[model samples]
Target: MNKNQPTRPDGTRDFSPEVMAKRNYILQTIRAVYQRYGFLPLETPAMENLDVLTGKYGDEGDQLIFKILNSGDFLKDLPADAVTSMGSKKMASKIAGKALRYDLTVPFARYVVMNRGTLTFPFKRYQIQPVWRGDRPQKGRYREFYQCDADVVGTDSLLCEAEIILMINEVLGKLGVQNFQVKINHRQILNGIAEAIGAMDKFSDICVGIDKLDKIGLDKVMQELADRGVSGESIAQLKPILAFEGNLQEKLTYLTTLFENSPNGQKGLADMRAITQMLNSFAQAKDFPTDLHIDFDLTLARGLSYYTGAIFEVKVEGVQVGSISGGGRYDDLTGAFGVPDLPGVGFSFGIDRLYDALEELNLFPAEATVATQILMIGFDEASFAYCLPYLYELRQAGFATELYPTVEKKIKKPMSYANNRGIPFAVLAGSDEMQVGEFSVKNMLSGEQQRVKAGELKTFFATK
Candidate 1:
């Protein structure tokens, strides 16, 4: 790459108009589903006070937050002698006071804490915005990408968790995702496994390692735990739990016995049972089919320490990408900010990953990419002038209508533009047709042409 050449930053992308259309299609589908579930829209600033985001997502997540340098001479505050010798950690603390949010959930907790008095109870809100991270980029991952999230706070109902499962299915179903699985587990259950194995003090370390199980494999995860100071004896006890296999009921029964002396484990098991029962009733009432794709995995730890209860991860089959969506229940996320005991549950759809999955499966509908519905072409100046009012009328009637900017002697130029844009219809008119107060409407797909009076263009497209 030339040094002087303009380029997008690595791990970011410039979306073409066509790509934007497809992305908007996905966003609209998600927004619609969120609205149907009674979630209102919300937005937060791109940068937050660094402290607000720092300790919320656990150590691994905290490291990925994109910090913003202080404005003007950032090093002025450092002592002259210490500036040259300060450690990286100390320098970072002194120089950066703001950072891009790592995710929506933490900032949301802060928001609830700040605005608790003015907000309604059990507030349900949805946010669609771009979040920045310092993560390594890959096929489905990016340094900057949009997260479409819907969350409900101020309630501890397991019904919220069940409804989230239903919304996950509905969003994917509407987006034409054919095969996907929503993997769910409870943080309490993970905690129980830690307790039963006698590694309760190292729970967070264990979670951070187990969360990498799918990516790093079991042997590597055990090694990571040992590196994090987990005992060999605890690892031995945890192996069978991590490798537990059975149907959902059997998994629940297995946990019931393992959690006999663990309160967190028992509560987690009861929550799972209540959530699943509500899900069945909700599905039956809504006439939503059950595919049994929602699975219970003993090793499913979501790494984020904030997730206190149910956690979810949605994976699409046949796509070489990571989970397209994930979130969990946070009973006291707001407590850190002085608002205690507010329980909330939510999930976010990784729009970029979902876009990748849909593209891989060729699931995007033809209409999703269509921008202009009709392009009007003129053989000469008079016909072109005549198209101006019809353009206004067609647009007034809710058609995406465009008239060629100038008359061209060669007909192929305008036709080619329409074809390249996937415009389905074209109106062709010459001096003769304009003189008769009529236009030629051509179906670009069938190449079929019809002559209609100027007053009838709207009605003509109305049928289409």
Candidate 2:
């Protein structure tokens, strides 16, 4: 690595102001929706005790954690033979005690447990922060990304699940995402499917394989299931359930019959039915927009070990990107932290993926990319000085305004600068306008000019 060379880590990125503006747009939309639903904002540290995150997310997730090496000669006290013989995995545990958080849910659970004595029951909180993972970076995945999560803890009500679904619909709808579906499923349903097929003990193996169905296709998923030692007979029985397709009610009806012999499956089906009914009733009562679609997807095994009940995933209709958001119900997430019996349900919007989708669809508002709404151009030192107050006032009036730094810069230079930066309006405060207390405002987009009194500049730009 050359000292003179500038670079970002391979899996990380630098968000330029324009990109940040768009990112903020998505985050603000999510935050507003979360707040509207009575969820309070909360934040947790970026790093946690390695023990805290280790066993939470299944085996694959554990491998992706970015562990931090212990500071101050971590190996000083280790036995030389132990270091030589112990595998890297075992050695890492001895040397590293802290790791960057992989997701918000675990940390939130930790927070609730630590604060359980002071906080009220059914705590509704939202967290907008970056999480780290050491996974290979690609188009939609990153080592560092933001997860906008809203969770309601300390309650096991089905209404919490329903409310989360509605929140997902509201956030995406408000963001102008035209084509997307909320795919709902259940862990118990997945377990029931496994049991129905006689793969009761291979539940995780079955889910790990089936969860890849969308990415690797049916044949590959079935092959993976076989490779995992699932019997051919079991695979045959599982195929149709994975292949089942219909409206929410139709799918539920079919699943009801399929899981009839499996108690877990029946319970999952019943839960799914109740949630869908409640959602439908809520939609009908409120006359919800038609753009939001909710479907029961039996194959939506979210792959996380913590999801004890309903699981949700949001996917764009016409794009090939991965799920833009996902989450589920965790019945005892707080139990690991000594606060057992506190159930919670929530979802996290992948800000990066959502931004990519919005950008691909050109859904961002026009103003999102504009850095400055108006630029103040000064012809001379006196004119520049004169324009300072007006510039301050424009900004004070809530317009993104800036004054050209140097008075000696030519008119064409400032105009071109404004044009290149996508600044919509430029205020010319040369000697003529400076003396009369009026300014010439040029519309950079249309090349039209208008004269406005200095005091009325804010109103003029506001209207424009």
Question: Which candidate's lDDT is highest?
Answer: 1
| TM-scores, all models, native as reference | 0.91, 0.92
Runs in model 1 with CA error above 4 Å?
A: 1-4, 57-63, 69-82, 85-97
Error of 1 at 330 (Å): 1.4
Candidate 1 least-lDDT 10 residues: 283-292
Instruction: Please report the candidate that would top TM-score against the real structure.
Output: 2
Estimate, for each residue in 134-232, the C-alpha lDDT of model 2 and write its tens digit: 999987788998889989988888998898888888888888887888988999999888888999989999888888888899999999999999999
TM-score of 2: 0.92
Quote the lDDT for 90 in model 2.
85
Off by over 4 Å in 2: 1-3, 70-82, 85-95, 290-292
Candidate 1 lDDT tens digits, 1-464 = 78799888889999999899899999999999999999999999999999998877768778898888999999898988665699765687789999998888778888888889899989999999999989899867789989998999989999999988888889999887879999999999998999999999999999989999999999999999999999999999988889988989999999899999999999999999999898777766655776746988777788756789999999999998789999999888688888788888999998998888899899999877778999999898878888888999999999999998988889999999999888999999998898899999899999999899999989988998
